[model samples]
Target: MKLARLGSPGQERPVVVLEDAVLDLSSLTPDIDGSFLAGGGIDAVRDAVASGSLPVLEGADSLRVGAPVARPSAVVCIGMNYAAHAAESGSLPPERPVIFFKPPNTVVGPDDAVTLPRGSTKTDWEVELGIVVGRRTSYLDGPEQAMEHVAGFVVADDLSERTFQLEISGGQWSKGKAAAGFTPTGPWLVTPDEVDHRALGLRSWVNGEPRQDSSSRDMVFDVETILWDLSQYMVLEPGDLVLTGTPEGVALSGRFRYLTDGDVVELEVDGLGRQRHAVHAYEAAAR
Candidate 1:
């Protein structure tokens, strides 16, 4: 099932996307947040749709689409999970997954404008598959047990500023990753049953020129392994998002020029969806 949110920035209403129309789920739930997902929301929506009991949302096409899911508790990210990306970044794939965090506030709607940081010269783009957790998980035995804890997936762009990430800020990647609107996620949150997460094509383009073209098959640490490994140390709660890293072909590899004002980035994951963002310079007064 495909779920989404529609309306202005902070006033979005939950919706279910059908063939050519969107059905309002506001009658059943307030918003698609952690509590909603944990409380059998998916099943309820499916039942409602199958029974033809949901109301078709009028004027939905006119409303601004927001991130499919509401703010999660944390947005966790894995670094260099792709073999080629690791090589491109001048490193070897680690035996264990490398983890980082992008504060929840960094998340924005897929089509939102991305603000380039003040005095930044190396803002880069990373197209990643984002995992959304559905249940509270801890100390999972292995990857075999990871699927049941996952709710769905979303397309995420892990935007970065190379200078803040590598050269300064003491080498903490999150320092460059946590800027507002840096993480643009979702046109929809697709359920696990609807997608074969193990194998999907993901690609990105800057201003209509392709930069990264790769598949999830190239991932060094697949989705199941990432969840299992993370569960051992931290509790994976409902609505927590995990960015599974990017494939090769990022600007940081010295292959393409960094993003500038007015540049547009388009990214897509085979079954999940596509996203577009226009880059703009950061404005101090807006903060």
Candidate 2:
């Protein structure tokens, strides 16, 4: 099932998507957050849908769509998990999964404006598949066990500022990745049963020109394995977001110019959804 949140930032209401129409789920749950998911929100929503208990959301089309889920506790990321993406960024595929974290506040709605950090010139884009966890998981035995913990998937744009990430930060990538609005996620959070996360077609474009064209099939460490690996070191909590790296064709590869003010980025993942973000200059007090 497709689930989403719609309204202004910080005031979104939960809704379920049925083809072209939207049904309000606010009567059943206040918001789709860690607590809600942990308490069997997906199952409850499914029952509500089957019992014809949810009401059609009025004027949902006019409201802004927020990230499918509320801010997660952590936004974990895998670095260069896609072999071709590693090659383009001038590196070899790693022997182990490279992990990093983007503070939860970095997440923003899919269509929001992305601010270019002051004095930055190498801002770039990455199209990634985001995994949302549904249960508390720790020290999972294997990939099969990891799959049982997944709640759904969403389209994630892992925007980066190259200078802060590679040259100026003394080697920690999160410095460049943790900027507000750097991670734009969702139009919907699609359940695992609705998507074949293993082989979806994922792509990205800037200013209407294609930049990245690849598939999830190219991932060096697929979803389940990455989750299994991460679970060994840290507990995967419900509503935790994991960005499973990007594929080849990004500006960091020296193929295209970095993003500038007014640039638009569009990303899409098969069976999940699409996102569009406009680049803008950073304002000191803007939230």
Clash totals in order: 0, 0
Query: After superposing candidate 2, which stretches have Cα over 4 Å from the reference?
Result: 283-287
Model 2, global lDDT? 0.93
What would the per-residue lDDT of candidate 1 be over residues 146-218, giving only the tens digit for each residue? 9998889999999999999988878578888988889999999999999899899999999999999998989
Show the colliding residue pairs in model 1. none
Which residues of candidate 1, in runs, are more than 4 Å off?
284-287
Cα lDDT tens digits for candidate 2, 214-233: 99999999999999999999
Error of 2 at 5 (Å): 0.5
